[model samples]
Target: MDPGGEVSVSEAPSQVPPTAMGGEEEEPGEQEEEEPTAPKKSRLEEESLRAPMDAAEHYVELRAENLKDQEPEEPEDENLKDQEPEEPEDENLKDQEPEEPEDENLKDQESEEPEDENLKDQEPEEPEDQNLKDQEPEEPEDQNLKDQEPEEPEGPEDGGPQREALDFSHTPQMLTGSWAEFSSLPENYLKGCKWAPDGSCLLTSSADNVLRVYDLPSELYAPCWQLLPEMSPVLRMAEGDTIYDYCWYPHMSSLDPNTCFLASTSRDNPVHVWDAFDGKVRGSFRPYNHLDELTAAHSLCFSPDGSHLYCGFDKMVRVFHTERPGRDCEERPTIVKKRGVTGIVSCVSFSSSRALYACGSYSCGVALYSCQDGAPVAVLPTRHQGGLTHLVFSPDGTYLYTGARKDPEILCWDLRAPDKVLFSLQRNVGTNQRIYYDLDPSGRYLLSGDTSGLVSVWDTTHCASYRSSEELQPPHLTFQAHWDCTNGLSVHPFLPLLASSSGQRQFSWPSDSEDSGSDTDLGAPQERRQENCVCVWWSGPPGASAPGPEDTEDREPAEQEVPVCV
Candidate 1:
């Protein structure tokens, strides 16, 4: 019990008296004892009970004060609650209201049809003398006239539409008796031949140390090409030097005879730049080492612009300035080598853009050099077991075509990805001789001469499709081009014509050398047989009377029977 008559519930026993909450009266004995203790308790007990009661009262008052402090504030202006809310302005309605005036104005304009009627009723005014001027004849001064009358349209042969596709169904008519009769001289086998850029002349190089430039007939459709007595060689070589390689300047033209200059490399001598019209040497450039040992150039090529001349030696390439060929070339050449292969540079070629040049060696791979620095940019290792004999770049310079000696496949390499070959074309390569080939002016077809005296034409588009398929198709067309091996091939620059030469190389048998004294017959020199002839082919569409049966009369013989060195 608390002193103030308040109960201390925490101090109470588990079971309280029945009268604790004033629900019922307590027993007399219990009530008497509780009343006495409550009034006469010790001072300490009174103080303890009084403490709890005071604390309870203080807590209740504090809670009431907090509740009063939590009430929200009220506005001081009392009239604000009585005002009516204003509605927001309707933007769409405002827009619609302003457009009503514009719509009215448009209606007013539409209703005014009288203005248009007035425009229609007004009479059209005429110029003063427009009809008279139109009706009058156009005099010579008033006419829209040209200084000279336009010439009549020329025929196809003159300036007409060009023929698109050439007929390959029939053999081309052979231009005979031009070089065939001339090559009949002893030891006068044709080595190299090229047609002029303007298709007006043909140049041939012979092993007999001669260069013959023949003037071709203007019309190729003549029944026969008659050899005129005046048609002699415009250029010829002096005694003792034999032409190994020759190339015409890329800008050569028949119209400007002064530009008809050719660069030829001869045995044991410097390269000579000859004037084709006058048979005179324009200039000569010799390549010599520090020891003064003369190096003979086996292959030569002029750059596309005729600014530089590249000559391939055994182990290096010598570059000469064509504009000033009288000066000697640098003593040190651009040498390139490969692992496990001795460098014997055999062939060289220049890209169409002249930004880069490529050189092929006997056992080494092909080396590509930049024209700016003359430094090697890339090396495409030989893919076949044989040596590269010939190389040519595509017209756009994106791909390179390489032919290897004794290798029956012609490899097309993508310059962007040169590590692997893009395509391999099959051809008959039974001989060890360097088989010359050329690409058409359009770069669409590749024509190559084979050891079987056949010329094969391949579609470059079809060959490039090998990247997508596994099986490769054969050449587009094939025809017998010669009776013996076709050693030289060239394509006309402006016409659908092909020029080829037939010549077989003779090799002495081993038994003939070893048993020279065993038999008197063996001592006798064997008569060397050479086809020694050149043929011009017309690739235009054949006429109704064209020869057919005779085309297949000289079919290619079996490969084993061909007299090719092993």
Candidate 2:
């Protein structure tokens, strides 16, 4: 700062008015020269004032000085102004090239509107058809709901499992002669039977504490066959005590070994998950009492998705993680604050579309709970005469079917209006045993077995919901299923078949006119000899060929069967 004679400023020429050229006379021609001189003086002053500015500010000032220098040059170019505006027009034309494709795209979209509208128009036609289906009150509502529900992993498509569409409009013909049966010894009477989820085989429990698996006979699939021979079990699972309950994994498939399993609970044993392919126990779920002593579950069922196993115990329900089978479990006690279902929980069933599950108690109570948190949703009033043994929800989740031990009537209750019974089905159930009943996949026909050894079929569509409870519903068809008590009935999941098991304790007494040993053995027996067996009957409408492996190639792609609406 001391070396320089004058202060040096690094900034733009300031616009501060230059010191007036006091002595200059402004003649018209001289005035323009004087204006130029004033600007030069201002620039000299601006350099000194800009000394304190930083580099960034200095750069900005320089840009301003350049713009100022360009100003006086503009008028010189004013004579060319007309040509400048036209140059911009040329530039605009070049810029519009990129926008041409966008205009074409808009045009393309406009042309496609009719096709999209056609698709929108077609979509409404389906809804119109669905409305027609809804107009028929006799049609089962589940058919429409299933079409709307998400397809299951094992749905019948894309080479997945397929089921025959069964029609109960007429009497079903027996697949083969009734002579073909899974005959059991008189000492080991059959107790119950269930169809595997895949409908490829049957599982039966006997009085001897043995569970047997019998594959569906191959001859039934053929066009014509001879008299079928007695069937035998392909696999046998022996338990230490009487089996309390057994349920096939809801998603079980014969193709996948991991999913092929069933859960069974016995009198004194922990719940065992048995491999369906092999008769070995895959895992065990052990539940202990408050005393920390191991206790057996009274009934077993897998959740709809098979992620959890629900086991029924006295006054409580224990849920076990399917993947981790051990003592650890989520205990949901039914009796909370001294108010809940009492007695042993005999059966549990889940609704496919709702987050609800139902538990039937031997105390003649039925309660529904949320599947999410196991919170009680509603407690149905006691209605059955005996301890409730089994309960099931209709496929549409709107109706509930319940049966009790030694109770002759199977009550159907409408969940929408749960205060009263919608209808009652009468059957002989004199003994304190679980008389299982099942509905077809369509939830239209209900089949059940009675202690009188008869299997009865009832069209649930005809059993109207009665407000006064006056309508008495009877089986549409009754057939002698066995020579002994038929305690179990299961409709094939998607097939036109029914599985029934028969046998109960029977005693024979010598006639009062006891003939010593003469010709007593030659005469007809006193009581009808007990027939302990499991039988499978075709439940499809007459003349419908049972779909089989060999039948797929010859069969035309069967037209989608329309829902039968009366």
Candidate 3:
């Protein structure tokens, strides 16, 4: 009953007044008579009467416990609870009501709304992360696309000078002939032929100490040409003595007049750079000897860039600045400090892809040097049987092919393993004359001429598995190219065409009168056949026909082909 008491709800029964539980009887005699023992109330009626009272007591006890645990409640709040006895019963009924749960649902929605918003915000980022993952693989593809960009420009830059693909699956045909063109003199013979870099014209050297330029027939690209006409020289350069060596400017182009010139060396003349158009001497590079006397170069070649001209001489090599001609030159001794390539430097060649150049000596020696300072790189052992005359590097700069005068074999040297020869190509070169050989632009085919009037073609893709000291590798194709000895061979820069020259010294002999055959012409002295001329052959597939003039004027039968397939 006291608000300050420490009594708990479980112990309240023991302390309650007896009247509340009917534990004490009101005067026994008066109670029995006056009330006649009011019928005992039913359990339901008693529970109904006690429920509100019990709820109020429980609420008061809870409030007392809360006040003790925290700050004390205000007196006004306690007075309000005591004044409204039925308020606690009403609160309990309200908690049990369905409408109160609806109020609770409103509270729950208030708490969960931001959570839903947070989940929505996260949903978009999930797709963004996925998008980033998708783009990861594309980065490399983008890089690859960028990498291929430069190669496209390089294709056009390099492709401008690239050689045209050739198909040699057909019988070779003669494009033109120059027999009558060179027949003006009795002993005149072609020495060599070279195609201009632009494929616009050709150049030829002859025993007459003359260099001739022949322009490609303009109308040859027409539909047909009934007769192969004799080719005439567009320009002729006469030298005082024998022409030792001559080469076109590596970057020679007809369209650029400044670059249209060639270099030549003669027996007693200085190196002359002649105009390709007018045959005028553009300049001269004069190399001097230790005696300070003017000397002629045995072989001459322009550097790959055409910035300098390299000349081969006996025991020395000279470099002349192309722009600065005359006596000014850089002398590089092949035999340096007592050791190096020996004999006359007969030939010089440069590698297009590397900083190296090769030199051949007449003493059967070959050497490599740095292009920068002419530093000695390597000197290959002497394997050639005669004086070295020509040296050429494979297009890839990984191999070197060497030929010697009077040597039967053109040796292929693998620069990667320079200690040994990769293979040997056999050709009949009995005389002490330079027998030139050429490789296709792709470096897949090797071609050369022999003294027996035959042209030979070798497939370089195949390598021999075994070796014998005296064995010579056979060519893929061999054919009698001329009636006289076929001595010069050159491949066109871009076309599927080959130019060859044939000639040799012939000795006249008197035939025995009694043993002379009936077919012999008695009026003429018995001499070797002299076919001293330039000829062009079409080396293409059988299906693709060559362009010729439509009219069949002055037509002649095709030469009898004697192709030997091996």
Candidate 4:
């Protein structure tokens, strides 16, 4: 093959056989015999001889086609096509050429322009930029000023001398006599009582298996010990089952009766939610255990928002949605006995902030559980030697207050340090009765009822002092409140008034021979207990014409004649 041409040497006449070259010498018969063999041999020899040439030619054609395809098409831009392609050496020489003269010329041109014109162009933008920078600092300053205003007042309100001025020094004065009393039947004594948050009504539950709502008279005022007329209960609903415990809805208000509801539980009955105005059952919740035993709620409380209801039982605390009472609670109860502390969940309190709940067990220990789960986050140590009776959280949810049966001291715990006691409050508690106690709105004073018929007030300020070396502080003031045991104690929501109830169960019959007729005489009726009544105390200024003992003598018998401490 010719290396650089379109034609190859294999196609030349010299490459043909010499016999075929003498074209006119062969006879016809000889030609016919040699024709077939000659053609076959010649064809084979040609193929072998031309294989390399054929391959080389094929490769050469492919290379030419590829090169032709690779060459760029004519540029669409005529200017680009006309541009001169500079040599590499010339480019290097151009770069090495000095640019100082050109730079000097540019500087001269720039300087010759009027400085006034340049300033004018930039002058307007300078003030705007300065204004933006000024405003950037002022914005944060203004926000900081606003933030500081509210925060500054909070410090003074929380810890300033104003809070210290709350006089725990002077003993709180009690009214001369009960301002008003709600008397239940002789067979039925007051079980529980709660003042409405708005202070317009009072709800009470009795052993008669009935819930009563009493509306306060419009003329009723605090600090007036004059006995008002016996106002009848406005609304009453009888629960066929024995009432164990009851609580007013956290959001209850007299203005909105439709939204006001109270919850009560019975021995084996479902939690009955009743409308405070209509005295009708709104809903009921019956939680069951794995053993198919009907778990009865002995103590229950509504969440601060009133959206959820927490019901405490023997060994667990059940949570139910207030709005959807009929719906099944998929969440298991916040178990209290999992950590070897086993007893009835006697009392449960939801933190005011709703971050955690403290459940007090009869085992004398309190378990703290997060709102998000059933398991207890921390098991508080058993502080009291007796069973726990009540649990309460401080307004800020930082501290927990627990009361125990026969335990004279109300133990306070810092939720942050549950293992150690923050302090203990002393009250004259000597009985197994669930002696109720309450914190005044300021949280400065704590009032508790005792078996001695005395309502004692403790200075919570002293109790909350983390630096105090004393483990217990005596009550700042104690007054003989009732003739019998004072079981219920509650502070009026807004007023300086306090409500307390006294009741006593007589288990033994008179030992006189005339009265002790027979053993079956135990079923006979005895002298009626006169102290089963509710009393309201006014702590404001005393009036000049306060009622005396003569006024109460005609109405009810005196259970005890202990002198009132001023």
Best by lDDT: 3
Which pairs in model 3 have colliding backbones?
Answer: 224-548, 224-549, 224-550, 225-548, 225-549
Per-residue lDDT of model 1, residues 1-566, tens digit only: 56655454555542344444444443434544575656555555455445546877899999888766773222211223333223212322333487855665665477455445544565232332566566666754354233221121122132112223345666666533244344456455566578876566778876677787776644444443332222345556552486667888877876678778888887888888888888788888878755687767878888778888888876667778887765466432455343222366678889986598888877747878877766777877567657878899987899899887787878888899887778877788876677888887667788888877789888888789768322434788988876566778887665556788666555554444355555323322233233556766667565432334355234332231223212
Sort by TM-score, top down from the best: 3, 2, 1, 4
Ranking by lDDT: 3, 2, 4, 1
TM-score of each: 0.63, 0.66, 0.67, 0.62
The C-alpha stretches of model 2 lying farther than 4 A from their native spots are 1-164, 176-184, 221-227, 465-470, 508-528, 544-566
Model 2: per-residue lDDT, tens digit, 19-39? Answer: 233233223234344655654
Q: Extract clashing residue pairs from model 2.
A: none
Per-residue accuracy of model 4 over 455-555 as CA lDDT, tens digit each: 88887776676544255787788877666678888776654457776665545565555666644444332333336666655553333323344554333
Clashing pairs in 4: none
What candidate 3 gets wrong by more than 4 Å, as runs, is: 1-164, 223-227, 464-470, 509-527, 547-566
Give the Å error, residue 402, model 4: 0.4
Which lDDT value does model 2 have at 248? 94
Clashes by residue pair, model 1: none
Assess the local accuracy of residue 169 in candidate 1 as a C-alpha lDDT between 0 and 100. 61
